[model samples]
Target: MKYTVSIEIAMPREEVIQLLADPAHLPKWLRGLVLHEPLSGVHGQVGTKSRVVMQMGKQKIEGTETITRREPADLREIPKGSVVHFDREIVVEGMWSVVRDRLTEAGPDRTLWVSESEYRFSGLLMRLVGLLMPGSFRKQSQQHMQDFKAFAEHGKDVREGKG
Candidate 1:
């Protein structure tokens, strides 16, 4: 399945980018995420890798993510937009799964973050699992977007000692 979500933050693009780039702050705002490990490469740059673990009820899945794109922050220049896309292969027990996410940003003092995910079921049994779990998946994605907005915007305030 493919889905997209967008939110406008009341913070500068640089601040938004900084918040998104930090791995330490993820669990505070990223829903379902229990662990995030920076694998390699420089922060906020393309080719950076991270190991992500997310929990859903009693099930936990792990995946490796590589930053597919990055745009530098520019204050004087107009906000041209940026995106961080992840290609993920998740494993649970003996089943192999895959998903992808694309986060995009636009507007001054604002961001339009979009997450798109595609799932591949291992077999007929897994297909049944997907069918029964549609609501959970949608809820997880929606919560992620909401948490991201709250974190990015409020995080700026907290850093400025306003929160």
Candidate 2:
């Protein structure tokens, strides 16, 4: 399955970059995130592999996420008109996935974030879930973007359970 979702955040591109790159802010917007610890390389750097654990309802899914690409390693001085890119590959027992994220300046003080995700399942159970409820994947992606926008714009925390 593959799908793309996007949202406009009322913040400068630079600010958005900083917030997204910071592991400290992940829990604030990434709902159900229980852990995101770097296993190798520097956190957020290209080639870094992180152990990710998320609690989705009654089930807990754990995966290893590897950072495949990060454009302009230095974020201190991003030139105008440059679109920031962040790409990663995730692997678990029965599924393999990749996500590509791009952030661009939408206006003087606004940012547009686009995320494209693809998933491949192996086990029968996993494949069935992917086949029967493909829209759920897209919906979850959009929810993350919306949660991020709220967090970035209004300092809302997903864990708080209140918008």
Query: TM-score of each candidate?
Result: 0.69, 0.97
| C-alpha RMSD of each candidate structure in angstroms | 4.9, 1.0
TM-score of 2: 0.97
lDDT of 1 by residue, 87-118 (tens): 45545543554445444455555665555565
Clashes of each: 0, 0
Model 2 segments more than 4 A misplaced = none
Off by over 4 Å in 1: 40-45, 71-106, 155-163
In order, what lDDT does every prediction score? Answer: 0.60, 0.94
Tell me the tens digit of each residue's lDDT in model 2 across 8-42. Answer: 99999999999999999999999889999999999
Which is the leading candidate under TM-score? 2
